[model samples]
Target: MTLEEQKEIQQLKQWLMQSQHQAVISGCNDILRRTREDMRVSQHILKEVLYLKAVAYRLLADVNSAIETLNELISYFPDYARAFQELGYCYLASDRKRAAHSFYQATRFNPALLTAWLQLEKMYKADNQSQALALCQQQIAFLTSLPRALLGATDLMHEGQLHKAEQVCRQFLASNEHHPEAMMLLAEIGIQLKVYSDAEFLLESCVTLYPDNDRAAAAYQNLLSKLGKFPDAVSVAKKRLQYAPESFTVKVGLAHALVGVGELEQAIDIYRELLSENEDRPAVWVALGHALKAKGDTREAVNAYERAIVFADDFGDAYWSLANTKTYRFSDELLAKMILLVDAEATKLDDEIHICFALGKGFEDSADPTRAFAYYERGNRRKKRTLQFDIAKTEKALQAQQQAFTKGCFNKTQGCQAADPIFIVGLPRAGSTLLEQILASHSQVDGTMELHDILGIASSLSHQATPYPLNVSALSNETLSKLGEQYLRQTRAYRQGAPFFIDKMPNNFIHIGLIKKILPNAKIIDARRNPMDCCFSGFKQLFGEGQEFSYSLNDIGRYYNAYEKLMDHWHSVLPGEILTVQHEEVLDDLEAQVKRILAFCGLTFEEACLAFHKTKRVIKTPSSEQVRQPIYKTGMGQWKPFESYLDELKDVLPARS
Candidate 1:
C-alpha cells in the first residue's frame, strides 16, 4: 500500500515541474516581445512630441524653444532641411535677419516649399541695394563680371548719378525682369527719377500678390510723400506707424510733416516729448535740431544734434549737422570758453575745430591778425581727412563755377543786368559767409547762399553733370568758353531785386583768372583770415550737408595750401577786380571797413551801413546769430587756452604771421 501511494505522488510532482518550466519560458518570451514594442512606441512618441513642441513654441513666441527643438530633430535626421528652414523661419520672425540668412543657406531646394522661397525673396527685397547685393555677392561676386558692374552702378546711383543709375538698373532688369529684387530695384529707380506714378503702380501690383507686406507699404508711402501731398503721406505714415510706431522712418515722416506746414514749433515739442519718452532715439534729436535751427534757436539745435550723436555714435551725419550750427561765429568770450574746453580735454574733434575757427575769426574781427592766423592754422589742421579734401574740392568747384558764370553773363543780352556779381572767396571758416552777410546788407547788392550755377557750367565743360568744369590741367580754350556760356545760362534764375546780384560763392578764388576773362565787369572780394585759425575751425566744425574736409588737420593744411595758390593766381591775373579784406582789419574797425567795402562796390555810404549789426537780414552762415548782435572782442587771443597743443601749427602759418 505505501509503495503504490509514493509512486502516484512522484508522477504528480514530475507533471507540476514540467508545467512550471513551460510557464517560465512563455513569460520570458512575452516580456522580450513587449519590451521591443514599448521601445518602438517610445521613439515615435518622443519624435512626434518634439515636432509638436517646436510648432507650439513658435506659436507662443518662444523662438529659442522652436530653435532648440529643430536642432534636436536635425541631430536625429540631418537630411531634414525642413528643420533647417524652420529654424531659419524662427530666426527671421525674431528679426535676426543675418542669422536667418545663414539658416536659409542650409535649406535644401524644394519648389513646393514656397514658404522658404518667399522668406528668401523677402529678405533680399527688404535690404538696400548695397546691403542686399552683399548677400548675393559671395555667390556672384566672382561668378561673373556683371556683379561687379552692378556694384559700380549701385555706387553711381548712391552718389546721385541718376541717369547712369537708371541705365544700370535697366540693364539688370533686361536679364532678370521677374527677379523680385530686381523688380523692387526698378521701382526704386522710378521713384528716384520722379516717375512716382509708375512706381506707385508697380508697388500696388506687388501688394495685390503679397498683401499687407512691408515692401509695398514702403514703396507706396515713400513715393506719395515725395510728391508733396504731405497730408496723404501722413495718412500713409500713420498706417505704417500703427504696426511699427518705433520705426525711425515713420517717425521721421511724422516729424517732417509737422515741420512742413510751418508747424516747426509743434515739431520741436513733438521731438522734445519723444526724447523725454525715449532718450535713445537719435533721429528725434536730429529732427529737433532742424526745427530749432529754423526757429533761430541755434544753441539748442546744436545741443539736440549732439545728443543724437551720443545715441548713435556711428552716425557721421549728426556730427556734420551739429558742427554746421555750432560753427557760426561765437562771441570772443564764447570762443575763449570753447578753447578752454579743448585745452581741458573735453573737446571733441568737432568742438575743437569750431572753437579754433571761431577764435581765428574773433581775432580777425577784433583786428588782431597774429592771433587770428594762429587760430586759423590750428583749426585747419584739426579737420578730418575727408573734410580737408571737401574744403579744397568745394572751393575749386566754386571757383570754376564762378569763372564760368562771368563768361556766360558777359555774352548774354544787355537787359540781363550784365553788371557782374561779387564773390567773396575764402576757406569756409575764414569769414567768407560773414563777409557776404555784411555785403548783403547793402541795398544795391543781393547776397545769396552758395550757388550751383557756376559749378554747373564748369561741370558742363568737363562732360560731368552737376559739378560742371574745373581749373584742372586738362582744359582746352573752346571747352572753357562753352563752360562759361553754360555757367551764365544756369545763374539767370538767381536774379532778384538787383541787377548786380552778389554771387558770394567764397570758394570762387580758384578760378578768378577764368572769371576775369569771362566777366570783365565782375567784383571779387577775398576775405582773408589767419590761415591757422581758419583751418582749425574747419577741422573742428562738422558741416551739415557737405564739406567732409573739416574732419582732419592734415587735409585742412593741404586745402589751405591749394586755396593760397589759387588766390595768388587770381590776384596776379585779375588785378583790381578782386578786393582783399584782412579779417583783423575789418574786426578792429568794422565801421571803417564797412565804408571801404561800400566804396569798393561803388555804392553811396548810408547811415544804416554804419549800424550794420542792427540790419536785420537772413544770415544763413554759421555766424548768423553773432552777426545779429554787436561785434564783440570775445574771440581775440583764444589760442592761449590751447597754446600747449599748438605743436601742429608752430610755424606753418602764412608769411604775414
Candidate 2:
C-alpha cells in the first residue's frame, strides 16, 4: 500500500513478466518477509504477490510449489484467470489430464486466453476429442498467430477491461502496423465500445492484409453482418467458404450472412445440414432455432430449442431461446431445473443471466407474479452491471439533439424523393415489431429486420466533438441525399422488389430530424405504449443486443421520458410527417388501426392487414410469438401486478400516454 512497497511490487511484477524466475522469487520473498513485519500490506496486494509467486515457481520448474501458491491465491480470488492459467501450466508439466481441466477453466473464465486455448487444442488432439479439437482450432484460427504483447490485450478484453485492452492494443498496433491479430483484437474491442466504423475499418484492413486468414475474414464478414451489410457480408462469406470448403465455422458464418440477407429458408437449410453433420453441437441447434423462430415456425423453433437443451442441458442460451418465444410453456421438470441452474455456482455469468430471465418468464406464465418479478429484477440487476449507461449523459445528449434539430434544421435541406422506406421508431418493447408485422402483411410493404443503416449513419456522425445530432446538423443537402441513397442501396438486400419496405429500428426515434432531412417522403410511425407497460415490459424482456437502458427500471424510465419528450418535439416540428400509434389502440380496434396505418403509409386498405397474425413472415423481436396471434389485451395491464415494486420507474416516468 505504501509508495515504496508499490514500487517494489512493480519491480517484481516486471521481473516475473520478463521470465526472470530467480529474481522474481527473491524479490517476492523479500516483500513477503517485510509484509510480515508491517501489517499495512492489503489483501489485494498480497493476492497479486501470491499470483506472481506462483508464476515464479512455475517458471522455476517447481510445479508442486506453484500449485500450492495458486491454491492459496484461488481460495481468495477463485475467478483469477491468469492464476488458473498458471495452474494449468504447472499441471500440464505434471499431469496431462489435470492440466487440460485447468486450461478449460482458464478459457471458461477468460475466453480470450489464446495460450490456454492453444494448450487445450493440443490436449484435445492428444485425447482424440474431435469436437473440442475442432472448436479449439476454430478459436486458434480467429487469431492464428498472436504476438506476445497482444496476449495481454486479449486477456484484458476477456476480463471485460475493454478500455484498457483498447489502449494496449493500440499501443501494440502503433509499432506493429497491420499485424492481423492486433487489428482483429482492437476491432473486437471497438465493437464492444460501439465504435462500429472504427471496428469495420480495422476488420477490413485485417481481411485485406491477410486474405488467406479465415478468422480475420470471418471477423470482417461478421462485422458487416452486424452493420446490416448483408449483401456485402454474403459476398465475403462466399469467398471465405470457397477457400475453406470443409470448415464448419465458415459454413456457420455463411448461415449468419444468409439470415441477415432475409434468406431465412436458405439459412435454415444450411443450419440443418450443419446439425446433421455435427449433431451434438448445441450452438447449431440454437442457430437453427433462431432461423426457425424468425421464419415464424413456432413449433419447429421450440423443437430446435429443445434439442439444444437435450444436447447440453446446462446451456443457458437454449433455455433463453425457448423463453424468448413468449409462448413456450415450461414443463414443471424444466422449470425446476432452470430454478436450480440459475443459482448454480458453476454457471457462468452470461449463462446465469439467461437462466434467470428464462425462470422469470416461466414463473410469469405460471401466474406467480411475485416469483416472476423477483427473477426479473435479479436478472436485470445482473445485466445492469455489464452496461455503461449514464442517465445524465443520455439527458445531455438528448438536450443537444433538441437544441440542434430546431424546425429550421430541416428547412435547410431538401430530402431525397425515395418514398420506399416505412420507418417504425419508438422505445423497445413498445409494439414497433407488431406495427412492422401489420405493415408487412400489406402487399406493397416488405418487412425487413431492424435495419441498422440509419443508426449506422448516426454512429458515424457521432464521432464529432459535439456528438450526434449537433454534428449531423452540419451535413449539406447533397450529403443528406447521398446518405439517403446509400441507405437504400444498403437495405436493398432485404427488399424483394416491394414498392415499400419496413425498417423498424426502434431507437431511430432520436434521429427524426436527420431522417426527414435525408428522406422526407419516408413514412414514420411512432409506436407508443403505456409508460408503465412499456418500461416494465422492457425490464422483464431480455434483448439479444442493445437497449442497455432496459436493464434497470430507473434507466428505462429516464429513457422513456427522454423518448417521449423527443417524440413530442418531432410531432410539433414535423407535423403530418410522423404518425403515433398507441399499442392499446391497436389492440382495442385492430381493423380500424390497420386501416389508419395503411392509409398513413399512402396505401389502400386490405383485409390481409387485419389478419397480420397469420401473415406468415419472419418475426425476430421478443414480440414475435405474441404478434403471431390475434390482437388481444392480455399484455395491457400485466404491469399492475408488479406495480408495487416499480417506484424507481414511477419516480422518473411520465404518466401513461
Predicted model with the maximum lDDT = 2
Cα lDDT tens digits for candidate 1, 1-657: 146434533443353345543333233334335545766433323333445456556656777867877777654443344555667768774565644553454433222233454566556666654564465444343224345545555545443455787788778868865444445556776766545556666765665555456556666666654443444555666777787778766666667765543456666776777778779988788778877775667788888877886786544345446545544444556556545654543234454555566566566556676776676666555553212134545566545544544323332222222445787777787777657767766777775556644533332244433333343324444554554555555555444566566666665665565555455456778888877767665554545434555555555666677677667655555556678997878789988888888788887777666556666543445666656656666544445454455545444453523
Off by over 4 Å in 2: 1-106, 112-145, 654-657
Question: What CA RMSD would you report for each candidate?
Answer: 23.2, 6.0
Tens digits of lDDT, candidate 2, 262-344: 68989998899988887999989999998888888889999999999888888999999998998889999999998888877
lDDT of each: 0.58, 0.85
lDDT of 2 at 426: 93
By summed lDDT, the worst window of 10 consecutive residues in model 2 runs over 408-417
TM-score of each: 0.51, 0.83
Give lDDT: candidate 1, residue 433: 61
